[model samples]
Target: MNVLRFAMMAAICIGGFFPSASSDALVGDKLYRNAHIWTGDKKAPRAEAIVVKGARIIALGSSEAMQAHVGKNTQIINLAGAFVVPGFVDNHVHFLVAGSDLTSVNLQSATTPEGFKNQVAEHVREMSANQWILGGNWDHELWGGSLPDKTWIDDVTPDNPVAVRRLDGHMVLANSYALSLANITRDTVAPEGGVIVKDDRGEPTGILKDNAIELLMKVMPVPSAEEMDKALAAASRAALSNGITQVHDMGYDEVGGLTWNNLEAYRRARRNNALKLRVYSFMPLTEWPRVATYIEDNGRGDDWLRWGGLKGYIDGSLGSGTAWFHQPYKNAPDNSGFAVIGSTKLSNMIEGADAAGLHVAIHAIGDRANDNLLDIFESVSKKNGVKDRRFRIEHAQHLSSSAITRFAVLGVIPSMQPYHAIDDGRWAENSIGADRIKRTYPFRSLLDAGASLTFGSDWFVAPLSPLEGIYAAVTRRTIDNKNPDGWVPEQRITVEEALRAYTSANAYAGFMEKGTGTLEIGKLADFTVLSENILTIEPVNIPNVKVLRTVVGGLDQYIADEGPVDLGTVE
Candidate 1:
């Protein structure tokens, strides 16, 4: 998706769909007709046309019925039988980091050893000698099972300090120069929940796993406010172009580095009226006192930017072989994954946040981590009394059969990334046995148990396309294309259900359903126009569907083909 550009007045013809009317006018801000509109409203379900006044959807019905709202100033649009749905609201993302990734080295496709070095070398050649090379989400699993070393990039980037992360963000490969800056030597001891890979002679291999990456983080140069602002702006335009109207920015790692700077950037963006998407952010859970004070001082923000939750981790990512599973990894038999933090400390943070009227969103991938979190939620509810505390378990990837129903019983939101399911499904059989893999990302069971599953793209971890996310959820097919019948096919959901997860379900989880999720009479005019009918299209063809247009608050944000519609921004 390209960065969205705004326009006040322009004309486009779409197969002669629009009537070239009297020079000058329409009363409503915008009129979109001839659409196969998926309203996301359970009561109506579909619509032929929609009339917008300013930022609100004033009316939606048959095209003829909506004509009453049109007048001299209306910027009418004929969809030419295009499909329309509410703009996606991603429930979980590391927004600030995602912004930075957009400008960093492209390594997500570096499948071979030479491919990785060449991509980094190309990026290095464009940068100043002293500039640090970062944000390469390289996946060694894509190639062979071997990991990378600093030696790979040492010759290509001798003058640069490089720290490129694994696709899952749980590990990083730092160049020799970066290791020297972090003072990481052969004698440096690894932290409790982390590992520094070593060579045959016990020398550091320059690969730091999980918490051990802190050594490099401590030495990373903080991005300036100007840099953060630029990144945020880039992210907003990209997201808006993709028809994402809002995002739940799950916290970042370092305070003044990416995480804290993100909060400041969000504030600045909101103040400047540059925040294109509604953002609900979380602070680090371990900083209980600071989080409490910030919440007390700022409260949950308005419709645009909010802070009402704390983000935490129970285990590392599955890609890094540290997901806290009850059983050991099939490939690494003797090792059941370790917890990212102690259980007692996690409980304290959850309790403190809840007591201060905040929600919790913890990253839990393994079955043991899921069970552990369920226990914590149960204790919190028992102690605090039953309330509408929409506590979320991020990446509830692996679950026990009984645990699936517990999500509904306890009213915990499984804020999951379906993209991870398809991505991980590729090599996951080797990570955990086929038996455990059967229950991994149990989307179908969770729905059957009445759990309102919300979907998101872990952005920098995966592509941020909700269309791809929906495709993965509906098909359950692995990216390797090996599972044509779908990986764990029983877990597949319908298109409607997947769409709801991307839009309305996300809004409900974020406490903003009544305002923006669905295309209703009073809802915000945030919607996307697609080239194909997603609801009626062949399930496999949905991923090929392109977003034709995007509108937020009655304004034209993106247009794939500006054929024959009068493109104008509402005043």
Candidate 2:
């Protein structure tokens, strides 16, 4: 018997925990040869060919070796020296929101105040007056760092109520109409972990930060089931096109967390064959009791649509000046940042979730927040007795040296977004000064300390492109080109390391490593055919490495028409 068949039989005899890859069970549907394949498996990291049978990778080796499984009816595709790697597993993303952002007003490129207004004005003309204008990921930092008030957009959106989020999703700029609809006034108090930016004479400035934005959440009408389904469909297409095969979606929305509603929408999409990429949805940790009940009724779900961990915010975000920090901000002296949930309650919530057998993935940005969350995770693990609970710290940015080392000691995953390093590297020193900046997104440090690291785009906040993320990690080049030598260049990693973080590492974090992640025998047949070899290219040119083709589950999900390269079903 062949090794693949022997392995399958052994697995079945051992009660079949790992997926079986029996030769007689499924023959080669397609064979891709003549490729520089990065397997992402350290044991056998490189391969020249791969055979796909059904949705699983049957074998990977030299071109001559893979041919042994090629049946008469099998289709063969010659890669012609192109590069192939495992499909990108983005560790953090907001799925439905990313889809909506695609069709929403394009404010990401709005360079000037006039440009921002013009984009919104143009978009307003196309929408009905009753429809709420949403999703303009505007960044004030690009346009001189002056936060625009309602007055800036009040004139253009007179008929429509607008509540647009900032690029970070930590704050919202509400028009006067939206404010009135929410009944928000100058006297309205901001929530504990939120902020209502005010103007002269203590009047509201239309900018709501962190939990303050939640105050106005319920004012807008909830999207109908049909609308939810449409958004999810758009998300799937967007993900597949970007070469993202799976996403550990930081699922749920601000308004009531929208757990069951969004879960149903994902289910509806799956039932209708509209799901293009795998999604592991996470619920808000604040809804612990409710989410536990939901999990009890639904279990952890399947491969296509998974119920991941409980997600909670340790604090707000850096851009919003609410990320819980140990020291006061260099820019804002009075601010040391505040926690979303108090330390005691935060500990309780995490412990309860951990005890319930749900993995915890908390959003911890600042040093203090990361430390606090780590301490809680340690306590919970000791009390519960560890048994492969892949607890995660989302963003895990801006850490102290102790906190960085603790991540390795506790076996906690530091779920990081590299694009933030380059983007924030442009101006983060101004907020926390040069001293504290050394510990910011310490990728190299984490890896050296034996800690597992995963990469994500934090989509909508950052573009959902693993190529762009890899470029950021490999180059550490600031977006502004201010740091040609790279911002904190010591933290920069190699292309192979970055690829693993984007694929295998992220897969391990999502508990999908057994079935997917590496392009190994018995793994899911999901891979991205690249236009150029990212590993050999100049570090700066990595972003130009286009995703020529994205294949998922033994089927082509995206094929670029711009190129004349013929990737085909050769019989």
Instruction: Give candidate 1 misplaced runs (Cα > 4 Å).
Output: 1-27, 254-257, 562-564, 567-571
Candidate 1 lDDT for residue 367: 95
Residues 1-571 of candidate 1 have per-residue lDDT tens digits of 0111011111111111132234122245788998888988876677888878788776677777556556666777888888899989998887788788888997998989899999999999899978999888888888887999888899999999999888888889999999999999999999878889999989888889888888888988889889888888888877877778889998568312456568888999888988777888877787667867886787768878888678888988888888998888999989889998899888988987888788788999999999999999999889888788899999899998778999999999999999998888988899899999888999999999999999999987898889999999999888989999999999999999999999999999988898888987667898988888888888899888888787877877777764336645433
Per candidate, the number of residue pairs that clash is 15, 0
Worst 10 residues of 1 by lDDT: 4-13
Number of the predicted model whose TM-score against the real structure is largest:
2
lDDT of 1: 0.83
Q: Taking the tens digit of each residue's C-alpha lDDT, what string does model 2 give over 530-568? A: 888898989899888777778889888887775325555
Q: Against the true structure, what is each candidate's TM-score?
A: 0.93, 0.94
For model 2 the local lDDT of residue 108 reads 84
The runs of at least 3 residues in candidate 2 whose Cα sits more than 4 Å from the true structure, single-residue gaps closed, are 1-26, 255-257, 562-571
